[model samples]
Structure formats: C-alpha cells, structure tokens
Target: MFTRLGVGVFIWVAASAAVADPVLQQPIDCTLGETCEIQQFMDHDPEQGEQDFACGAASYDGHKGTDFRINVPDMDKGVAVLAAADGVVAGLRDAMTDRRVVLAEDQTAVAGKECGNGVVLRHGDGWETQYCHMKLGSLVVTKGQKVTAGQKLGEVGLSGKTQFPHLHLSVRKDGVPVDPFAPDRDGQTCAYDAQHTLWAKAFAKGFIYQPGKVIDIGLADRGPDLADVVDGRWSDFVADPNAPLVVYGLAVNGLAGDQMQLVLTGPDGEVVNVTQDRLGKRQAQWFAFAGKRPPQGGWTAGDYDLTVRVLRDGKLLHERKSQVQLTR
Candidate 1:
C-alpha cells in the first residue's frame, strides 16, 4: 500500500475522517484477462496475495488501479484504456506544470523531477483508480460521468512527464494505497528461462511484494534505522481533472495478466517474497503486491536495490529498479 501498511489503517481512518462517502461497488469486469500468474511482467505487475492475478498490468506503488501494457503490436498506436465498472468519476485536478522536465506538467515537481497529465476515480471502501501521464487530449470519459467495465475511457499517449507514452494506474482504499503485488513481495521469483536459474520465475508471477511498502521500510521512525537512503521523495496524490495521475507522476501501458509470480531482494541480497492482489474497483480493476509481513523487530538498517523485470519469450520488455533504506 502507498505510504506504509502499518500506517494505512490510520491513514484510512483519517481520509474518511473528514469526508463521509459510500464505498463504490465492483464497477469493472473481473473476467477480462487470463488471471494466470506471470511474474516479471512490467506492464501488468500486481499484488494478489498469492491468488491468481486479477489482471496482467501491475501498479508498483499501489497507485490503486489494475493496468495492462497492451504488449501487442505497436506498443504505441495510442493504447486504449478501459473502465473497470460503473461509477462516477471524481477528483478532477486540471492544471499544467510550469517547469519543463519531460512531457509532464511544466509546474509540478516529482522527487525533484516533474510529472505529466493524469486522472483519478473514487470507489467503495476507500478504493480509487488512477491513470497518469497520458497524451495531451486522449481521454474519452468526462467529469462526473459513470462508466462500465472495459469501457473505452481514453487513449494512451506521452503527455505529462513521460519519456514514452504509457499509463500509470493505481488503486487506493479509503484513500490508502494497496499493494498491487498480492500475497507477498517475496513469494515467487521470476526465472528468465527454465534453464537459467536464480529464482527467476518470481518475476513472471507479477505479484506485489511487501518490502515495497513504506511501512515495511519504517519511514515514520525518527531513528537512524534505514541506511543508504537513495531516490527518496514524496508527492501529494491529487485527482487530475484532465486525467488520472499515478503517484510520483508515472505512466501506464496496460494490464499484466491474471496471476503473477513475484521475486524480490532486499538490502545485502536478503530475499523477500510477495504476491499480487486484484479486486474490482468502482470504475476499473485495481492491483497491489502483498508479501510476508516484515520482521517484528521493525526491519534492519541496510541499503537495498530491487531489480524487477517483465519478459515474454525470455525477452525482457520492461523492468524497474527500486532503492530502499531501513533500520530498526
């Protein structure tokens, strides 16, 4: 989940503290993709908590929506994003950034970087889906409108803070982020080839790992626990009036698949297991990565780097590397 899982409960309570709204029902079609497990799928990596992947596309930061990369011919062709179910679109933040980083808003700053265009949709149980950094004018849905699953919501493009055209989708519960990698982060390790070893299969599962959680890293402690803090920055999660914005200003490609195997490594090569969580959203499918809860000692201080790769036919299409710091 976004922020930290330990604090998610509190944050959820706080998000609902001021506003009182009903949780949207399952608005999307749950039977769109294979729901099979495919790890190292960059496009549709999600957290299912060991359950079959709800969909292929994966969201790294529990941004809250299920995504599929459209890993077919023409990675471009302006990918078409669809609605997961029927629900009213909410959180419309329409503004252009001032600074010029990439295609992102000229004014916004992300971890010292800039961002692009994005959107957000609210659902039940604090669940919300977001799509980010799309083409300038490709959205098909309008504000305050209701949509059904697989509904053409918009076309993917390289708009806000994007190097290439992609969609950054996420899901949030009660305004709290849920791990797209279901089950646990270190549950499965993706293998490049049946012959190539080194716990590679986890990558194919496309599940969310727990180590990615902000809480597991002990971000709140004022103590010198985590070390080698690199690539650290924070941003506010606001619903874009123009489009759905992924947290930290990211882009989406498409959904990964049904189920995914996850494999992760922490500081000093310590292994972490995780899974993906797929659940229907008020508008679309949302995913998160789950894994064995961090140790009770509150984790250990260390420098960690995670290399996540998504592949097909033993070919690496997409991959992500995350830096982490923790100390207890």
Candidate 2:
C-alpha cells in the first residue's frame, strides 16, 4: 500500500564527515547519478553477508571492484574515464568491441574477458589499479607510459562481461585484491565500521547509501532513455497545445512495495498532474514517467517544474526536480 502526501515545503539536512584518505581522487568527471555513479563496489564479505566498499549491500557476492557507471546511451555519446592517481601504465587491452549485450547470459564471447577493454596501472609502492570495461579504440595511453591524476585513459563502455556501461576499478596491494574501503587492506567493512573506511573522506561522505535513487530527469514528447538523457534530448520543449506533455525519469536500486509520486506544474503555476502509484517486486533499475495530451485549443506558455519522489513505508527516500520551459 502507498500513500500520496500533498506537495509540501522542500527541506534538506546536511551531514558531514572528514575524509581519512588523501591519496586518490575521483577518477571521473561526473557525480553520483549526474554523469556517473558507483554502480557496484567490491564485495568483501562474500560467504554470507555481502558488503560493498562502503560496507553496503550495493554489491553482490564475489564482486572484485568498484563499478563507476553511466547510462548506456551516455556511454555511446562518450564520457571519459580518468586516472585516479599518478601511475605508470602496466598493461592494457582493446581488442573487444563496444556493444550492448542486453543480458549477462549473452556475454560469452567476452566471457573470461570480463574486463573487455582495460588498463592496469602501477603506482608507487605496492599499489596498483586496474580500469576495466573501457570503450574499444578509445584508449589514450600506452603501456609503460606515465600518467598523472585526472588524465583521460579511455571512455566507459558496455564491453566484456557487463550488462550495462561502466568502468570497473580494481585496486590491489602487492598483487592481492583489496577493498579500497578497507584502510587496513584486510577484507570488507560492515555498516557499523564506517570510521575505518579508506575512501577520500570528502568524496565518500557525499554519496548516499540509500536503496533507491533518482538518476536522470527530462521532459519529452515520448519516453526518454539513457541515450536520450545524455544527448540533452528533452532540454527544449515547444508548446504544441495539441501534443503530449511528458516528463520522464529513471531510477535505480528499487525494491518491492515502493511508491512513486510525480508532480508537474505549468508556467501559470497551475498543477498539471500528480501521478502516484506503488511499484511491483524488486527491480535493479526502473523508469517511470507521467504525461498527458494538451487540453483543447493548445497549451499554456511559460516555465514548467517537474518534481519526483520515491517513498517507502510513508518515509521519503529520494526526490528530484527539473525545470522545463514551454514556448509559443
């Protein structure tokens, strides 16, 4: 069962924690769900309780790295995968082509080639990082080449043994796989061990460990996809007065019994529609939208605001807002 709450005032609370690690910088230009997000984290506790570098179940059994992901459509458009730290290129692979395999079962050709197009870097001391699932033919560095932090290495892609587009970053110490979240280089961290996390304190703190997240938002004549979001497909809207006024959005990490609410407001401050419904069983990712054909004679001109919210057990979980303008 789901309940719809009236449009209330927006409030935000800030929680800050100091970072403990200062060696590595974020290797990508996008933030969580902005241009990219940590799709998966290394699985430290694989036998029973699965935990990510953040000590969350965002990861599954035996996952060996952190997956920084952009939507498939965005990967096709091109998003750079940068070096997280200064290091010398140790190894690389670029033979695999970049193509969406829609399903994990269909990735046999690149089976053992899990890291389809990848690069391994050797930093000072015993630290080594491997960047995986890069776009074919997009490699910008060569073996043995020294690179600085933030240097572009390649683009994220859906090559190898992945069903989506992402860069799998694997960190190792003395050739042993290590969870970056574990400063002690042991294994994994449970939720209660947040203080021992090794992530750049600032970058780690900003990421919300919630189960549901609103990834992208847009206004389109039709439903938009990951590719559409990357291309700025719905950035502009013309008031056809006779056409459909649609606002679409994408979400991930959804669970059963979740509720969604979408509120659309017109330029004249009139409420267009408020779509609310309960979601089905568990879904790793979901796309939800709301729209309707314009009223007779045409539509109103001016600014429009779209607000989306996800709720569980009557508690607000996630909220996103996007503004679009209607023209004459």
Candidate 3:
C-alpha cells in the first residue's frame, strides 16, 4: 500500500554535511484559484490531529503530499503534470487503469498500487520528488532518463485511491517526507512561513491560502444533478424561455455553521431567493441551489443573473455570479 508516515515528532538535527535544498516549480500546468486549486497540503501535526501549513484543516491526518486538483471536466481535457526540478527518473509505473475507488472491491484492487501510474525522480544530495496519479500511458520520460525542471511528465488522472483527479507531489530528503511549505518548522507548529517554502519565487509570491471557495456555478433548465455539474455537463447549458430555471453552486472546504445563499433575477425582476440553514458540520464538498418554474405567460427572454454567496458568522466568505441567456 502507498501509506504515508505516521504522526510523530519531526526534528531536523543538523547533519555532518549540509545538503542543498531542492527548489521546486509548480508541478501542474494550471492557474491557481482559477482552473485549479490546492485540494490539500502535507499534514504538519505531530500528534493525532490534522493541520496544514496555513493552520487550516486543508489536510488530513498523515497526508504526506500536496494535492493540485483540477475539476473532472478539466481532467477530461487533460492537464499536464510538470517535473518540479531537474533530476534522473528513479522509477515509474504506468500500467494501471484510470478510475476512482468507490467500492470495497475497487479499494482492494489498488491496495499496493495506491499511487497508480506515478514517477519518482532522484535529485542530488538525497533530495527526491514523487509525482503520483498520472494518466496511464501518458508518461513522456523513461526510467533513468534525465528530466529538466518544468518538463512535461504526464497528464493528471483519477487513478489509485483518489476520489478526485489530482496530482500528488511528495518531496523527500533521505527517504523522509518533507513539507515544501514549511520544511524547517517543527511538526507541532502550523503557520505560513513563506521564507522557508521550496516553491520558486514566482509561484511563492502568488500563492494564497484558501480555506474555502466556490468551484462551480451555473444556471440550468431544471434542477441539475450533482454528477452532471461535476462532469461539466452544465457548462454550456442553455435554458428555454418556458422552462424552469435553476441556479446551482458547488463549494469546497465548507466549515460548520456556514450559510449558503442563492439569488436569481430575471429581466423583469427578482425571481427567486433563498438562504439555506447553517451547515451542521464540516463538509469537504457541498452544493446549494435555488430555482422556480416559468411564470404564467412563460418567462421573459433576455438575460438572467444568478448570485451565490457563502457566509460565515454573518460575514461573506466567498461569492460567485453567473448569467444565462433565455431564447424563445
């Protein structure tokens, strides 16, 4: 199984000889907070709790890698995974099929191959980097071949024990996992220490710590299915003037007590507005929608606007606005 290091103290005692740190570039070819986002980070907690470098619950217990995630639709189009630094290919695996693990049988099938279709690169000075969950048959570099930083390695995939499509980048020194965000800090402390990050200057300057944000929003002719939304089926949806109008929003990392609201406005005036009850507990991913059937004489043509907002403690956390055109 592709298990990670268990919770324990991480003290960086000085070595007799100093090792050069491996400076890293962005591993995925996508804009952060737009086409892709950081789904998770390496856990920094020393005990049984979970804490990301930003002191947020954006990570799970024992997570040893940073996850760069693109939505399913983007995955279908293919997103390239780049080498974080120049190194020799240490090893690779590319025979696994691309599929999500949703059943017990599926989990059993990927027991020892949890990091399906991955590559390991060995940098000098005991530094190494591993890229996991790449698409099968998409690898461009061969084992033992030298690769340059930012070289295209493969496309992201939904293989292994993943529930979503993402590229997991794990950094290591002397076979021990390291958090690129705060590599020198003690495991018990969690905070954004930009000066200690391994990310290249450009990427580090633009990085932002997002605890929760909306991923998708759209207007549909009828209530849209969650699967359809996730698959980008509603990306190009057009509504008929006489059909019902539904506005839906998808968000990630929603905390307990957060409130989601949806407002729809037609050319004529306000059509529907709703504020859902506070969430009972933390949600990794959640969706909220509001809509209404056409009026007595059918809806007015032109443009309809939908606004979605996430609120916590009566303050706005995130907001998205979308518009759809209705034709006769």
Candidate 4:
C-alpha cells in the first residue's frame, strides 16, 4: 500500500495514510553484524566534505550513497541484494567483468565503469533508487520489470570503483539526491521527519550509527577466511589440545590515534598471546588477531577466553569477548 502526496515537482509515497512517510526496507538479505556491515553512508555534507546519516565521520568525501559491505572472501559466495521498495526497473548495466580494480594505480581504466553492474528502480511518486557494484553475471532482474520490496535484485560484488565488496545504494527524489537519514545534512534541525525519511519505521532502528564497533570476533584453529571469519566452527566447539589457537576480531569506524588490545587466556589462567597498538589516520574498517602454539604438554582440557578492547585517548570505546573449548 502506498499513499501519494505532491509538493510542486517533487512527491513521495506515504508508507501509511496516517504516517505519510515513504517507508523502505533493508536492501539486502543478510543480518547486520552477522554477514554484513554498514561501511559508509551518504555524505550528509552538501559540499563534498564528510558526514553520515548520524552526522558522524563514517562517510568519506563526496560519497553519494550508502555502502553495505561484505567480506572479500565471501564475495564469491553469492549474497543477494534486494529492492528497498516496490518499484519498476528503470534500467540496468551488467556486462562488466566481476574483477577488482585498484583505483590509485589505474584510474583511467575505471572511468566509465565507476558503478560497474547496477540496477535502477523507479518507484511511484517520482522516487528513484539505484543499486550499484553488483556481480557481473548475477543480475536477476531486467529493465521494465516490477519488483516487490525485499525482492532479490543481484549479488554484491567487488566490481567498479571499489576496493571492497559492497552494494552502493543511491536514493533520489525528483532527480535530486537526498539523504535518507534526514532532510538537510546541515543546520540546526537534527530531528527526523516522516516527510524526509525513506526507511520503514522498524528498519530505521537497525541503523543507529556507531562511531566505533566490533562487528565480529571468535577463536580459530587456523587463521581465518578474510571473508567469513566467525564461521561458527570454533564457538563452543571442541579443539585439539596441541593445535595452535588464534583469537581475532574485525572492527569498523576507526579513527586516528585509536588504540587496540587483544589478549588470549588459557585454561590455567595463563596469558597465551597479546597484541597492543595505536592506529593511524581514519579507516573504514580494521582486522587483528593473536595466536600461539600450545604449551609443550599441550593445552589442558578446559575452557579458554579471548578479549578484545578498543580505546581512544585512554577511554574505553569498545570491548568484545569470545571463547573456545579444548579436548585431550
């Protein structure tokens, strides 16, 4: 159901008659913090500066869309990108090869293929949305077709002007790009209005922006797949007493001068491994791990603990704990 309202040349579909807001669903099929991460948001700043939906520095310069990213190792595993609302396919591009392009080294080759594989959707009331960076051959919908909210559009990919695997979603109203988080990126009104928001009331809660967050953490026998680190294979799972053990975590929204500490404790209350350091510059995401071989007589058959801490200026910012079991 959609309610139409017109204001000059611009218009929007109200999620409900009583609300008068154009509600949108999450444009992906995976759970946040489980299979994906909100890498970057639309630049709330109008002059190509930096700001996010929450008025934070999570976005980069001139970033015009919301970036939902997946781990690089999982890019080939086929994660589906979905439509945010019911709409007709405006157009699409899919012939580009699904390959990584390092922008700093070769900018010329990626001139016309900045968006790589993309699908454009035209909703009622002059609203439009574009999903970019799809896998080369994974586009499932064609031009002029109708798609319901949550319908699969394509798989996320590393194609185009991207250093990571992600889906870049651009939202527009009457041809002008609008920030979905709020009406104006600048000024005194930080409150969200229904007329200015394009997300479902329920979906809006999932987007509470955090400047620094530990997305995932776990223990592993080997290192870890760059894509799928917490494979659920080590959590409470039995491990060989003598096998080398590793504790790792992935973080997002890191700033310059942030410090990180990782510690792994054995069954006998002994510190097996530790890592401490300060990060440099701004970063969208970072990963770290610590590991060591078992003692000469092998680890005791008991529970082990791993803890991760992220701090800035001596203040605790984030902390996460993971565990594993060992057997003789």
Candidate 5:
C-alpha cells in the first residue's frame, strides 16, 4: 500500500531514462506568490537527504511531487486544478473526505489513498501526470476522458495524507517518478535550465526557485496562532483601539539558524520590533509574531504598518509587509 511520511511526502520508484517531455502549463489557477505558493518541490536528491531543484531544503526526503499550496481561506473559496498537458484521464478518485491528516488515526484512514481524490492523465510516450489532494466531489473529469492543457480537473483540498491544502503534482515516465523541473537525469543540476524543464515558456518563467518564502502576514488584535494563520482567519480580523496590536508572519522552508523579525509602526513612530530566536533545525513551516498591549489612552487611532522579515546568516532572505486600520 502506498504511504506518506509527512506533509505530502510519498514514496516513489526509481527514475528511468529520459523520454519525450510533456509541455506543461500552470496546474493551479491562482497568482503565484499571492494567492498561492509553491511550498515544496520534487526531491532531487537521490539519497536520504532532501533537496529541491535549486539544491534547497524546501523538499522533504522521498517527496515524489511538487506541492502547490493555497491558504485555507482560498481553498474554502475554491481554486481549480488544471491539467498540465493534453492527455486522456487514465484514472480518478473523488469520494475521500476533505480533511487534513494530522493524527495517527488520520494517517491510518488514508493509508493507501495517500494521493487523495486525484486524477491521473496519460500524455502518451510513456509520460503521465497525477494531480493529488483534490477536494472531495470536485473532480470534473472521468476515466478515459480527453482533456486539454489548462482544463480544470478539480480543486485543491486538504485531503488524504496532507496536513494542508495543496495540489501535489507528480510526473511519471514509464511509471517512474520524474521531476518536471529537472526531467533529464543528466541535467539535474541545482540551477534551472529552460532546456530541461517541462513547463511551457510562459509558466517556466514564473516558477523561480526560492530557498525561503513568506507565505502570509497580517495584523491582529492579539498574538496570532499557527492554526489561525493556516486557516486564514487573520485576514478577516478587525482591531479596536482598546485591543493589543499584533503582527504575525507565516513562512515556509525555514532553515537552521534562520531568524524572523517583526516590526510595527504607528502614525507616531515605531511601536514594536522584535526578532525571534534562531531556528535550531529545518522547519517545514514557521510562525512568529510581535505586538504590544494598548497604551494608557488605548492605541491612538491611526494606520499601523507591519513589516516582517526572515534573515539567514544576517542576510535578508524574505520579507513581507501588511497594513491595518485601528478605530476607536
């Protein structure tokens, strides 16, 4: 039975020699780095270690697919998953419940169905693409149905062996897992080569590799929680003058020794600025926040700006800014 280790980490067979490459399109219908982010990539390292196509630790060991993740609020609104290439649907599943696998029992429930409600397409020449973690009952294609590139197959979801909502896209050649970013095994260098990529010209240019990324940032009335951030609840929160003004940032692929800094500035001047402790080890996801309670007059009604930055070796790696209005 197929099994997953962590967030979308799955097993794969050995890769085969190169074959005809499939000209792929963006599989998710959302603005990259805005409504969605590429949280993980296919593991390029063949050993127990993990590495993305850019030689970064964004991928987990044995990860067989590239994970295109969306914030939970966006998932709730529905984000379509598109076919990456012209193909015939080989198989599909749509009955699984849309829920994250966080506990041991949840893992057992999805044991062999680690791909969740997914669709498999055969693009001929021994090339095939599998789209996993689709929302339950959102599949629009059926077995043997012909689909064109960019056609909607389903919506991304928190299903099967995943801890978050994402579309896990896997490319296989002759039933062997292949990295679409680095299709040719011979050209598996850390640097991206347009000649070796499967993405179409337009899409290839947008899939820039990043070692770290700030996925979300927001201003809240109180300290933010990881669950609340993942659920995207902070986006709707309204702050009053009497409440504490907090700013939180959510990031992915935080390497060891990385530090996160949060700063808030009011109409008057700087309010709160704090740098979190260095991460002791690699973290798939990291959350940090800083804030201050209301002053004697209750925070002066005005506009507040929050700046969040991730630093590695004292060098800025990623930064995000957000603004919120405080009313009396």
Candidate 6:
C-alpha cells in the first residue's frame, strides 16, 4: 500500500527499483460537485479512451506531458491545482512559450494516467508523484517540503500551458508514468484513499454547489453531456413504504446487466430485498424504479437500508446507500 511517510522515513525500501502500492495511488482531484473535463482515460474507461482524439503529437518533441481541460459544466473560473502525494519537489520549469512547469516524482505511477502541475516528490518504495500546470506562484508547497496526501501543493489555475485549471496528476513507479485507472496498481498512493477522484473546469461563474442538491456532473463541452438523463447518478434513497421507493438519475457509465440496485434491510439483522435494475448502455436516460413495487400482496413498508450498485461483468464499480422510512 502507498503511505505518504514523513520526511526522512523510508518505510518500504526496494531492492533496486521497487514499485509503489497501487492502492495508494492518488487520482487527479475530481471530487463531488467539482466538474472535470477529462480529455483522456486509463485502462478502466476504454471506450472513452478510443473516443479521446489527440489534437497534436505527444509532448511536441520531448515536452513529456499530455494536455487536458477541466470543462466541467456550470464551472467557468475553474478549480485549484493540488498535489497528489508527498515528496521532494523538483523539475520546476517556467518561461516557456506556453508557460508550463513540471514536478516529476511520486510513488503512484500507473500507465495512461495524466496528472497536471507535475510535482514529483521522492519518497520510500522507489516512487514519485507528478503535479502539472499550477497557477504560476500558487504552489505553496516549496521544494524539499514534505507533503501529505491531499496537501495543497498549490491551487488549480489555468497556467503552465493549460487551457483550464485541473491537476494532470500522474505517478512514476521505478521512474515512469503509470496509468491512473489500472486496477492492478490501484490505491498505490493512499491506503485509506477510496473516494473517487474528480477534475472540473469553469462552466458558469455564478453556479455554486449546494452539497445535498443534485448538480450537473458532466463535461458538456467535450461532446456528450451525460447529465442524470444522458448520464447516471449518486443520490439519496427514498424509503416510503407507501409505494416501492423510487430511485432514478442519469449517467454515461457502466455496461449491460448493470442497473442500479437498492438493498433494503430492516432494523433486524435480516436481508429484506436486493433491488437490481438494468441501467443499460446509453449516453443518458431518465431512470426510475420502485424499491418494492406495490405488487400482488402489496410491498411491506418499514425503515430499511438502500444500496445502489452499478454492476458490470459481475463486479460492482460504483455504489451508494441511503436510509429510508417506509410506510404502509
């Protein structure tokens, strides 16, 4: 596992070139409510990978980095750039025609991964991190400063030859960029890092994220805006026993036989019912299903647990849960 050890502490030492823990890998920041316009993908989203059209050649003669945008719908001013791991900062480049810098070195490195602002910090396990395109002087974390996971190395800004403000975070295992979506080396940076990553660009300056309220989470400018309809969702559960609680949303993720499942269980240690619905494979859809449709004998109404799972190849990639109070 990848743990951001403090300075001077090398926990996992490699014989020659040890690989960092895949599970500890930190992804580019794409948190809830933050919009990330992903110009590329790793191994996980292959279809998306195919759709990703490269505008120009790779690195333009050894520039050593890909370009991306944070065209998140509803965001206009963009978000802040941040560091993915802890390490000694190096490779600070500036004054180029496009105006970009690179901090290359961190423990989490999977192939096909793109971490902007490229801040590489050397640590134990022969690993390093890369944060790309900071806002000129926004990088508060200086070289030689030991940083922890989620530490604000700098704020995301449209600097360093980038069109938007999103961290193009990547990792170097044994001195090479690694994919951020590979499962074999998943979590190569943070042992306790399970939350999904997000990167958003500016859409509209006035829109603010209200947490509980549903927000448009999609990269509209990049073609196919998969809102809750054309997309899928992560939402609260409705436990109104009066009717089979309805769950619906939209998203452009998951494969066939992968519908949203709602797991309902009462206070007692008993499994009442496992709700499963096929989301199908489409850009977007308005989905709505009753947890317990008032069928023949009528559905029982009571407090229960609801777990929404997105399944594919008999695996749950995404899932969410909420409590509901059912009624007769």
Identify the candidate with maximal lDDT: 5
Candidate order, lDDT descending: 5, 3, 4, 2, 6, 1
Model 3, 179-220: lDDT tens per residue? Answer: 888776654555575666888888887887777777778888
lDDT (Cα) of model 1:
0.35
Residue 25 local lDDT, model 4: 90
Cα error, candidate 2, residue 25 (Å): 1.1
TM-score of 1: 0.36
Question: Which ranges of candidate 5 are over 4 A from the true structure?
Answer: 1-19, 185-188
Worst lDDT 10-window in candidate 3: 8-17
The model with the greater lDDT, 1 or 5, is: 5
What local lDDT does model 4 show for residue 225? 63
What tens-digit string does per-residue lDDT give for candidate 6 at 81-108?
4455545665443222222233343222
What TM-score does model 6 achieve against the real structure?
A: 0.38
Per-residue C-alpha lDDT of model 5 across residues 1-328, encoded as one tens digit per residue = 2222124334444444345568889999999888889999988777798988778898998988899999888898899999999999988888889998888999999987888888889999988989999999899987889999999998999877888999999888877778887766453456887666888888787666778988888888787789988998888988888888888999999999999999999987898899999999999999998888888888888898988999999999988887888878
lDDT of each: 0.35, 0.68, 0.82, 0.71, 0.85, 0.38
lDDT of 3 at 305: 88
lDDT of 1 at 322: 51
- Per-candidate TM equals 0.36, 0.80, 0.89, 0.81, 0.92, 0.38
How well does model 6 score by local distance difference test? Answer: 0.38
Cα RMSD to native, each candidate?
Answer: 19.6, 10.1, 3.4, 6.1, 3.0, 14.5
Backbone clash pairs for candidate 5 read none
Q: Looking at candidate 6, what is the lDDT of residue 160?
A: 41
Candidate closest to the true structure, highest TM-score? 5
Q: lDDT score, residue 23, model 2?
A: 59
